[model samples]
Target chain A: MKKLTLVLTMLTLSISISFAQEVQIHGFISQGGLYSTEYSYIAENSKDFSLDLQEIGINFQTDVSDKLHLGIQLLSRDVGVYGEGRVTVDWAYGDYYISDALKLAFGRVKNRLGLYTTIQDFDFLRTWAVLPTAIYDLGLRTVNATLDGVQIHGNLDTKLAGNLDYAITYGKLNLGRTSDIAAYAGQLTTYAVEAATTKYNLGVNAVYNTPLDGLRLNGTYLRTEQFAFDPIHQTLDLTQAGMGVLNFDYHIETDIDNIYAGAQYLFNKLEITAEYNMGTRHVKEYITGLNQTVLDMIGKGKPELSDEKYYGGYLGATYRLNQNIGVGGYYQIYMRNDDLDDEDPRKSTSDIALSLAYNIGYNMVIKLEGHFVNGLGPLSVSLNDELTGDLSDLEETWMYGVAKISYNF
Target chain B: MKTKLLPILLLLVFASAFAGEIMVANTVNPEMSAADVEKIFLGKTKKWSDGTNVIITTLKGGAVHEAFLTTFVKKQPMQFDNYWKQLVFTGQGKMPNSFATEEEMLTFISANKGAVGYVSDARAGSLPGNVKAITIK
Candidate 1:
């Protein structure tokens, strides 16, 4: 933490000097709290809730010359981790206006993954407390958060009558090492678990907007793959011939494919948006050799091998009460299929959440949200239990409320 | 509601009594379509034809300018709600600088070469040497 602060101060000084010529500083800070009733299966008891600073970022944009513009964003984001100082060279490149129809950018840029991900810069474009959790967890960003590649993205507008207005882009996905640790309340130890993993990725996406008279319609699609670094394999041990095998690790080379589509309609005072996403995840379990303790846990559990699929979607709506204020609501649902043996409790389960918000000012907003979850197949008595077992009448529903406040400067 | 409507009617009467013209302009070479103008005001048009940055200035808040936004731009003033929502939600663009009144708007417009803005159309002819009003109609 001290190292992060020191580096930030030094970089701020340097940026304020060299690029101070045309630097524009813009950012915002958001803080909020969540409280849940007995409805929440995870939080069975009502607990004192506290608001933590979500994200605070400063973006510095400078124009090097006529053809070039550079931008760098330093953000303090709390994603499971306490605070990760994530720095992104968001847009460092040149734009050559070849014509009204053709323009090219050579540098790190947003790939327009979804209608809002590319600009996830702002806080109010969507109905959720934040962006759809599924999109953020599944969709691909430039390098990790921002893409490090070149792109030709622009809109096509024509004056010769019946033509379409559209925006498009293509780019490479981030395939880098991801390492982070997180901790929450009721936990004495700070370092719970760690993940040292890597992935190979590639992606492409586009969105088209068509306006007819007073109404507007938009649709978008994105696809990407993440191939883990290790191969998946499974092994078994019998009494005489202690070792047996079923290697699924060979499939590790394959990448997961995620696809999504969404449509939005906006008329005078009301707007509606709906989106759906699907992805294929191949789980690779490698167990070449096993001790008796591990063997006893599995209990001849078919070499302890399995795979599953996941998919989800969200729908939202907003009504403009006046020019400066509006009311909105949304509901999101997600499902994960864990294809395991009949005894496994953590099978396919569905989760849903609802939210309502109001735009108070140009930079201030208030959001209230709740979650309703059911058909949660199973629960583990201990956090690290590998063999998840079903809970007696585990079928439960829970509720929570969240109020969020944010500002942009 | 009657009391609220009364003040608004009076404000409209006073505004019409002292209505003024507003002028608009673009750079020298390229022609700007209505769609381009919309994008410029919306902060999507970052660069001008001559390679200068585009600065969008507007009155901070009110109904008159909101009406102009709804009519000429064909977008809801609540789109401003959507705009800030996008900024806060997606982190794309920032809200443009604002002026308190039409006079201040015109003054800023005259000072910045690449700046674009609006005021009461009745005051259009009185713009300064560096400022000109492009026709919205």
Candidate 2:
């Protein structure tokens, strides 16, 4: 049995309960069991029941004035070698409400991606035990979770079209050295990253609440400038006639552009949603350790690689059988390299997920979910510690199950 | 698909089972439209026309709360609660002051300067001195 990292977490001990009544403070903690039949999905030990999936978050918010509000949330989690129970500032910002039409905020702001990005935390509020892996890839969560800079958002009411809520953010992605985004960049050169940052990024998300009582449509777009990844000390040894050893490094840069569109209908107890994501990542790799003669002989070719287009979508629905019991599921199709056909098993993944959740009350929820997946996209072959070295061999089909209990106040 | 749709359709059909009459009251007591009512309860409208910060109140969870959410706010009780939770966690908006009973909600509306809330029609007969019910257009 894998070690059960403390299953029950009580985070409110340090918080003054009496003061909490007056001040705005909230939190949630969840423990999950992850089991996979074959290849490891998230944690390296998920081949068996693993308790490595857990999260705890606490946030404090206050209103300085009617026009300005400030808040900060701290989060800690353990998923494989990624988080490792390290606490980090999830999001902190000061929002200045200028009017019903426009509000400005600055600091670490949530990246308003598609329907679920903004609310990735607070598991009890969502229907799925795990978000659709294709669109909400855990490996890329750090890159898509939050941005560091400024945001302007508000609502616009139109007599004809509908009520539109929109947000525009300009910032750099908050990527840590060990996050999958940075690690993936380093993997291109077979090196390790010490530091990384996105140069310039602008994102826009607009949601139109249609006149129909239960329907809404949303669209989001993100454009990023060149991303810089500084590699740790590396040495590339070459076999040549007179070359003894070469001490050199490579510079890795990439640019990403993303667009997502979706529609949702919440009719009483039935909620249905359909969304699609499409994007292209342009990777520019440079080998800096070779001499001009060596570079010429090596045929370094063009430094810039052609853009890789990726596309994916999901159709999902959830029904509240009553208030306490609800069942939900989704069918998703994803293609990592759109240039290739579905015949390429490693580049394509399709998944079917079903879940049943029970709310003990308003504050606690228990959920059990099963995922049937086909292909290698969800395995994170290039990122996971256990899965990275063995890329040549992989199962085309796999499955995993999750059981989680969460509480909040 | 039909088997899955059966439960959903039945739930949709029976959603009207949540029935009751409730009055939307506020200290500001401004004339508004049904759209305005929806926006206020949703925290989309944070201020009143006179430029006062609008304070909101609600009953924790009950038949009256469910009826109020369904009738005036046009949202499921759980959905409305989750919407506020999402906003509160995101720092977009604060959760409205929630009470266990309509009496407590009425008391909160009376004490706060620009507070707004709702109550069952049965309780609407007797009004507090400072709180007044507003008509939704």
Candidate 1 structure quality by residue, lDDT tens digits, A284-340 = 433434554554656643343444566666777777675455566666665545454
Docking class of 1: incorrect
Tens-place lDDT digits, model 2, residues B1-137 = 22321111000011134325444444344356656667878888888766767788888888878877877677888889888999977768778988998888776666565677777767766666544545555
Instruction: Compute the DockQ of candidate 2.
Output: 0.52
True contacts kept of 1: 0.28
Is model 2 an incorrect, acceptable, medium or high docking prediction? medium
With candidate 1 superimposed using the best TM-score fit, by how many Å does residue B66's alpha carbon deviate from the native? Answer: 1.0
TM-scores for every candidate against the unseen true structure:
0.71, 0.88
Error of 1 at A147 (Å): 3.2
Tell how far residue A341 is off in model 2, in angstroms. 5.1
Interface RMSD of 1: 4.3
- Scored by TM-score, the top model is 2
